[model samples]
Target: MIETAILTPLEEELFALVNALEQFGFKKHKSLLGSLEIFEFHELNLLLALGGHGKTQFGVQSQYLLCQLPQVELLICAGAAGALSNELEIGDIVAATATVEHDYNLKFVNRPLPRFTGTPQVIDTLKQLPRTEWDFRLHFGLIASGDEDVVTVERGQELAYLTGCVAVAWEGVGGARSSQFAQKQYVELRGITDTANHCAAADFEVNLASAMFNLAKLIVRWQAAKDYCAV
Candidate 1:
């Protein structure tokens, strides 16, 4: 069984499987920091939680909570991202085989920070699933995760150039760091709903749902597989 975690309600709906929901709590920890909700489908276990922006502070906290579990296997993160590359279209999916912190790079100034990397296990798992040509395309590339919501085209391009990544999302870098410490295979998937240029006046909530809906299809499919295997 592979254990997974989603960071938001939008991500929860986007990646939930058809399993009974289980509630969990952090010991003496306030829910304001984060909550624990596990969903079980077939024999697979998933932990769904959220991470808010505060200089990756929430992520470090989440990692501490996950350490208490000591049984989580794989981590999958799904969220909305701003498209930085011209090759990506709105509502399209970008599956990350690897993730890096965009703001951590300082090689130009003689500072080198170790980048957290994910394994190929995610690609292998997706390959196990039946391949059907779907409406949205799945692109595997470098994803830059950070705090700021990219809202300018120039900023998007600059970040893309800095990280050499195609997409930008808010929380995956934190997830990547935590997952690395857990020695779990990490898979970060994202959907682009707006170009940085259009994000200035876009309805973020609506776009977030659109991305979640796109991920929901995969969730349902995984759930169906779980049910079938149980039979």
Candidate 2:
């Protein structure tokens, strides 16, 4: 069984993906968390939840879902992100090999870097999937996560230099940390929605829908190929 979490309810890509799966007999359920929405794909033993936005919410909801759905064998955190690398373009997809909390720091003492590497088995599984023909490219790399949206090119460059990350987002590291603590297999896939610049908001607005849709499509494709129903 697989458990998937996204950050927001208003995300059209997620909404479309869930609705499409519903036609295949997936059932929606009410969740205990106010910001969360639950959907079950009985045939595939898949559970989907909306974890709300931000790092804290993602971490809390990931733990809650993991505890509540102990039967799930894998956890996927999928959403949109800003490209930190010049190689990345809007609407491209990134399957994170590792995640780092770039905004985390100690007040005065030197703290170990907050980096979480995803389960290798899960990462390998994703890497082995057959590539589908799509307009956007798929990349495997590190992703930096933080509470603030990176808006300047210089800031983006600094983060990439620090973490060697190709993209940045608000919640992937939270989910990664939660999954690590639970000892659950986890993977994160982010679709690029902007280039992290002065024009980030405008670029994000233009690319968000397409990026989200593509991410959902990739998930659905992987589930189908794995014959999730039988597993």
Candidate of highest lDDT: 2
Stretch of 10 with least lDDT, candidate 2: 1-10
Worst 10 residues of 1 by lDDT: 20-29
Q: lDDT per residue, candidate 2, 33-131, as tens digits?
A: 444567666555466677557888888888888787776657777777889999998888998888888888878988866888877876776677777
Model 1 TM-score on a 0 to 1 scale: 0.75
Taken over the whole model, the C-alpha lDDT of each candidate is: 0.62, 0.75
Q: What's the TM for model 2?
A: 0.85
lDDT of 1 by residue, 42-122 (tens): 333454555444337546745765675556666666667778889988767788767767766565586544455656755
Distance (Å) between predicted and true CA of 32, model 2?
A: 6.5
Give the C-alpha miss distance for residue 59 in model 1, angstroms.
Answer: 1.6
lDDT of 2 at 198: 89
